[model samples]
Target: MLVSLEIERVEPLADGAPFGAVGAYERVVGKAKGEVDPAAPGNRGIALIDKAPRNASGKVEYTTDIFILRPKDFSRGNGRILYEVNNRGRKMLFGYIADGPQGVNDPKTMADVGNGFPLRQGYTIVWSGWDPDAPRANMGLGLTAPVATDSGRPIVQKVRDEFVSGTRGGALETFKLSCEAASLEQPRARLTMRERAGDEPRELPLNQWSFVDARSIKLRDGSKPRPGWIYEFHYEATNPKVLGLGFAATRDVVSWLRYDAAALAVTGGPISHALAIGFSQAGRYLRNHISEGFNRDEQGRKVFDGIHSHIAGVGRIFFNTPFGQPARTGTQHEDHFFPENAFPFSTAMQSDPLTGKSGSLFRGDGSDPKLIETNTSTEYWQKGASLLHTDPLGTTDVTLPDHSRVYMIAGTQHGGRAGATTDAGPNVNPRNPHNPMPAVRALLMALDAWVVSGQAPPASRVPTLADGTLVEADRTGFPAVPGAAVVKVTNQVAPPGDWVNPTPPAKAYRTLVCKVDADGNEAAGIRLPDIAVPLATYTGWNEYKPPYPAGELADRDGSCLPFAVDAAARQAAGDPRPAIAERYKSGADYQARVEAVVASLLADRLLLPEDAERYRERAAKEPRVAP
Candidate 1:
């Protein structure tokens, strides 16, 4: 099904990589050379963002870079390619390293991180530049796109830009979205300020804010931007890039690599099957990619056999639109008005009773891939993950299709903290410390089995309304724990008009959080040993302390509070719950409890045996647990 594919070249990795016998090479996906091949219709698709004019070739030609890391010897490799789409500029391809010996921030042994598990497994890993604006020199792949314009005129659309800073809010109106152009004659823009997410937004007089460049918007007084306040500017932006092509690029590249048999000479053979994983923004991109019918190549062959979107809530991206800003991620405070959050947020088919519109996230092109979506506890609290499994009205559970599975990692933060302990991550996020990697590793294996061996993954472990497990945030059975705010997560809604303006959702969808047990751990989903046998009361929701959208979820980070060591301590803090010291006779007792929990998880197939052992071992090392 390939239009054209060239090996470009292959090179061995420098010494001291954790990849074992694996080698790495960079592949080049170039623009079409001769007549446009339908299968490699690089930019032939319509640009929904702008009715931009194109050349006689019919579409803009794009050339980009992709990287492959596989066994140097083709015979040693499995026929599977794990295509990990980058999230922004960072590589999560090795994030599972958090579960291994070398954790993040390992400069000296970064190559040896993750214990070479993926390499030893003989799976070939590949990644390509999808987002054109993804930092190239900053260690990200490169994507080049043709500029989009309307019939000889620059297409301009009202774009919303929001900036939040903890320390350095530069003094100037130079907030550029990727690469955009503001009007030359003093662009017209409006600025608004809100000290807290709950605070009433105060509109600044038009005279107060002006653009310094496409990148920055600042006060007319020339004062430095303040920390902890949200500065939002709504202005006319022009020259939107054909960002949606990035989606097609992913499809075409994978299709060419997986189906092009010519590669067998050097790479052994075309990959038998392919899978993709995207986290956060990239995850949302995947959602938009499949939902927008980009999973199939121009020749109509499936690109990805299986898809895993992680930490992406009820959102897609402003991927392809007039003045498109594919990088803008909608949040409660930052970029809060992007098109990422839209209807049909779930993969399950259900009618939006209000609009009487019904559909699922599948393309309906018969090329929909098997999907396995996973979210952390933070999603339920912040990202409306409940929407994935529940009806839009949130009154009942929407059964997942047999081909799709939804899993929620209990008591974890967004993307989960890596190598998390009872302590929170060093990053400023205040959420609890729940490592989602072990579960992620196990689920990926399940996804591979589902695609290769036709074995269904474990039954969906998401919370449900019928079971009383999925309930409103305020309804959680959590005891009155100190320093914990079981507050409601914002439900972003909108009416029909002025898509770019701040049109609040006319009505709120039913936002639900998971129910908790006596120990304050989520009881509905896959709970690793950390929650099953806990020392601290791990939580999915963490509060913004002072500045930075106060009272909102801490940008998806969690909070971990070790239960008071003793009942006296709990009583002094006015905590109604018992303490870890009171619950477990000693660390060994905690270890035994964790072991039992691990055994149960293994039996349920929620966790693999190897992962269960790792969990047990980690629990044993916790200061609260003894050998």
Candidate 2:
């Protein structure tokens, strides 16, 4: 027989409040106070208030009077309600309440103005399947008894460490109780950043930069045979001293699904979150390399050009370098960033290296300035494959042996752009259009289905080429290569100790100004090793264009952040719609696309007629929601 459970409270806690608290009742009162009209479709009125008195030790105790709703299938007997309670809102307390006919209602009451001594403030009903020996035929009110409580100490301590010392407890406790009642599971991913401390210089290798670790915890019960799985978290760090060996690693553990694994799914935030921290740390380290001059000049322009070239060179070095080469554990070098004999132009510039021209560049004397020198053929640009083929983050050492499936995506930026917009001024836009969440979710769903059923995922589960065509899978129906590889390593040559300055000196400097033209003037200032360049050459850079107002230049300085190009610009620039659309569509579309591609592989036989109809029907249906 099917059983339905419905719970209602007369004086309920606020939207987010722990049970049995004055604030909880206050929330209900607040809702009643804000009600414009009770008859409105969405209007809800508060039903009760709570008042607590402090004891001798100044600790407050509270009691709540709430009306509980009965389930439609009520069969009175010994009924119990399973729920959780939290302290304030921080600590989680899991427990149950029991009710019976013996302790029904109390007639001894206190009288208030305009009310009787004994009042029916609220009612609660418990429902269960019909039993021949049950005490009552119809539902009735009964006394309440507390059951077991789950400790909220761990969650409360974590919040205190991460946010404030004690402010978050109440909010967290209330959230926990509400989540338990609604059957929502907390996300189980952790984002952490690790940098070498001054005392631990020996622990980190010399010349290595920083290290970031993204961990997704998978909890499992020892009694269950199911194994744990941890997906690879990407890591990237750069060190100028360690030429041709920028570190990168990505590792995914193979294992069976556990209870928590089914509830807490892997999301895209871990990889990008770790990368954001790593990149910020890298940018701080590279501050000295930034150009020290502003405006167009014979020497300053050359310096700016050189800095851009250096950044491009760094990009080439990283892209061509492979993880774990030459030595097994000791320091090793790979030319993946700077491939042996291969030019760096392919990975460095937005324009063709051979042409020396950019789509954004205009014609005239300013075009193809002789000051621009091409480093496409530099030694740093050469390409050659690395000898090492093992996982960089040492996944094989930490992950379960049973875990097998691994997927990686490459060529995408660290964090995806939320939407297309060219307004990202000086800084790199956080929201790059190439966000990997949609694709990652699709892959995870495919993995889930593959694990639950005997069927394997089709090759087209991975993203298609820039064109709107499906990429064929290997004979095994899986992609031949992993998505992307990320590595984390410390600089072995110039350890932090080498540059440690216990008594750093103070600095003093002044600003310098120069004339740009009849209506413009350029200003320059020194900010340590790095030069500060403003958005406009003379504060009138773009001549008051569509994106600029009079006397306001598109500042490249920290004042104006850089943003990615948006959809309108992409379309105008001839970007293919299908290529971009596939990245954001729902999982159903992704599944359909994969199945369509799979159908093409067996167009001649039973695979087409038998599987096509079934797959099409499944694709047409919306994703199943959990009951």
Candidate 3:
């Protein structure tokens, strides 16, 4: 294996504070190894993967980018390394409060480093580019790979491309992901119109569209497609990038930082322990990394001591493919099906009753590290978070390993906002004000303590079918709130397949959703102090309007409807639920309720003392309840 690291550039970050600011560096890691096959099962990704023929050196060559954020003085830093897996070239896990658009380790300026939380924590942070398509400016990184081919001829393959119109327009302009043009100008095109997930799909004829350029497609009659309609084009695209190498590249980099003493010297001493944190797309990547056994390096040593997977749900990314689009996280209405949601859905090793394939994410080889997996209420309705705990057949619950804990942040959307009230998000749905980051921060501290002091983290708390909290989606007892889009909360799964010609063994497996109480709050999962002491009805599902179906859960958004200020308002609406005033004698009483919830969580080891006071302050400042 030709695994090597080179420092490209180094600069000071964050004005060189007490830890003397942060020392940021640009790096390139290249590996020379035997040729790899993209079709092999576990071999889907291995080491620093290469798709092209080995050079005269008799080794395949591949290079990928990485950005390291360390203390100027290594002694001033926490000996731990936090490898943040980037989602489409953006660094997550820091959970920063940025001044504007910010990339976590993006060089040039860590100026407005959003509260600089990570900096204060003293952990060395690292970001690397595994996606080849990522741009270069603003600290964007990428991997370099050769096009896969057979002999001297180009290897032709079928590819699937899904197009969703972001804006309403007369003509929709489409572009290819990895390839330049279609091998045959007109391949096979299919268009479908659907207002929502369960709505009947109306297919448009192939003759209605044609290719404008190698990548661009246009309507044949000079007309435009509907804004919410989904368009799929399976064309003969050439020069498919060896996208599978991305997973391998990421594995090698993390491995190098963990074990390579020389590489570790640059950041002070060797990493005594390492933790990986990813949200959404990046979260899925972390799941695949362990599920595929990428955690065991070439030397057969574990890479991370723990991983924090936030909002990933049960789906691993469709990251390995001929022309992989690492950024695409398919929703129900758009990009219907691809390889994003595949088998081995749960962390435990189990037999797929349908496919007869048996595998587990852990090796039991003493390399399976501890894990803290957190999700929001949105995941149950959208990304199939329930499936992670449930069996493939959704018959029984799957027992989690002792080292792993799964918590669902009740009544919040994916990556919720801070200090938000009943407000509309940038998406089509109104935003749920519930923020999971505070709970996330506390859990992370628990994870760190567990790793360092051999202390056990908090118990896993999530909705379960055994308990009435986890129930069928349609059975959630939601209260009547005007304009609340409380639709059937079920998983929308499709058959996993090849980009173009997919031969999935099954269409969709059993789906489960969490049960909500009369106030529309999820009954299962970790209830934050705010959730336990409620003001508004925080929910995990929202809806889209017109062109899109109304009651369908809006993509990754949630809803928040403030309760009636008094019993008169509740009676006026004919709503049976008691109003906020009826529950709490005064605003001070509400603050005490919030305090009790926080104290309970703190005693249970789920909330830190520092965070307890923070939550208390948060409740005290709630604008909705203020006089």
Candidate 4:
């Protein structure tokens, strides 16, 4: 339970400016102190919890950085709470939901609030650090967790670390380890380099590289590692943290605020319901949290009423284990051996014929909360997102539980950055800049209604085998555009235990992706105006340029290949996709088409009004359809 909350500071938010009907808000910054009984049923499942140091009451103690924003006048505030699990200790809620600028981890000004969507809705915005090893830069929030020991002695374990230099200027002269090395002895560690994940590693001579310190290593002769090369390090490390406590910490913090009267002092008003939204790694954390049964608090109460798991695909965090690394994510071209993608990829129950293990993300207990699983196109290409709704073999679609909904934000990349140009790092084609935030804003409101008032959300929107919109990667029917690379590979899924083995089973789950239209745009999911009235062929996959390994997926990036300007340009470029001039009669015509799609989406409750206007405004200035 949350033992105490140490308030560090409290101040007016955005200079005390009123936000629509929500009135002026205040920010509360503090540290949340909590503990869990190792012998308790709620805590025993935590890895190495029993080995952690205990307090006077025989409880393992922990502290987490907490930040909250709510109305100054408590009675005027919404009784709902929105908690965003920090991604690498930085708060991303404002950037995605509020359309706020990035790198504003510490929001104190009106500009930091962007359009003020959340504040206007009167939500008590909450963020508490759940990652123990989350970086401290950029005012990052992190948890202070206890390390596990064996009978008062340090527990030692072997840890693996991987690094890659994807750019020409990127060279590794020195490398840092997540965990401190137990010894500086060269023989105590093994280092190897490979050009690709599937290639055989070449062991570096001991004389070529030496340990710079217990926590770092350097090349002796000033040798810089080659770009696109994967460096693997295996070393002995001591002190494994009770990382699973992070789940309990989050549960107790939310539970205490909802159940304990002392929470009134923090929230200003009582919080009747809570919702959680996470992106990428944090999103996968939510999956692990629910599957591991952390949704049920120590007192047997549900924690979050609703959850928005975004862009996580069919992955879970490599958390809650001995020497777990929460920062590592498994992608096609990187971090391949991590335990991020494995069995039980779906919330539905299905058996992995290879592993002989059968289970679902939900525990089937009454503690299960309403769930909304959303993903971007990059997830289908690089993270095996189809598994979330498909069977283990990817041959058939599985039905989601009544309380769950899935939506695929079509024609976008992993991080939906705004703007039309693709200036992604180390990618051959322009990266996809088709932001899907507008659709997300609408979905969040729908999720709130589902949890707060038992209102059903919009039906799930995703490509399915039954509809013939989901197909194998090779059969996506992607256009043969000039200089464009078709997806030849997708992330393979193996049993959960295969992550730790040197060689996983050669047999793997079948990979699938959303089919595309004649224009090379995704044919399914929530299509925004940018996709509906397209000027480019946006895709979920981008190829790595030279220096980096060719033919491999450019780490979680998507491609945006714009069509030719006119018929002459189209014929000259041999572009099969119709030219912008040929598709639309005039710029005004294109704007009308975009507005029509936006209006339809709004009627279906898939697009917010403010966001719909933003789309229309952008369409008016679209240069591709200019007269």
Candidate that scores best on TM-score? 4
Question: Weakest 10 consecutive residues, lDDT, candidate 1?
Answer: 26-35
Candidate 3, residue 573: lDDT: 79
RMSD of each: 3.8, 29.4, 3.9, 1.7
**Model 3: worst 10 consecutive residues (lDDT sum):** 25-34
Error of 1 at 7 (Å): 6.0
lDDT of 1 by residue, 519-584 (tens): 788987888887887777777776665534456545556777667877788889988777777788
Candidate 3 lDDT, 1-627, residue by residue in tens: 225666665666645444324333223222222233434443445432344556665545567766777776676677788888887777654443222233444533444455455666778777777776767566666777667666656766666676656422233555444455544445354545555434565766767776666657676776766665666556566766667666666766777777777676556667788888888888998888887777776667787889989899887876666666666776666655666887777767788876677766666777677888899988888888877888877778889888888899998888675645565642344678787776787788888888888899988898887887777778887777764566675656654755565443455677777777777777778899767888878877777666644444567778877788788898887766678888787768889989888888888777767668878887788766644
Q: What is the lDDT of candidate 1?
A: 0.68
Q: Per-residue lDDT tens digits of candidate 2, residues 216-307? A: 12212321111110011122211101111111000000000011132112110111000000111121111111211111222112111111
The 10 consecutive residues of candidate 4 with the worst lDDT sum are 496-505
Candidate 2 whole-model C-alpha lDDT, 0 to 1? 0.18
Question: lDDT of model 2 at residue 266?
Answer: 17
In the range 227-315, model 4's lDDT, one tens digit per residue, is 77788888899888888989998999999889899999999888999999999988999998898889999889999999999999988
Give the true-structure RMSD of model 3.
3.9
The reply for model 3, stretches above 4 Å from the true place, is: 1-3, 19-51, 95-111, 167-178, 187-213, 218-225, 419-429, 494-507
How does candidate 4 fare on TM-score?
0.97
Distance (Å) between predicted and true CA of 461, model 1? 0.4
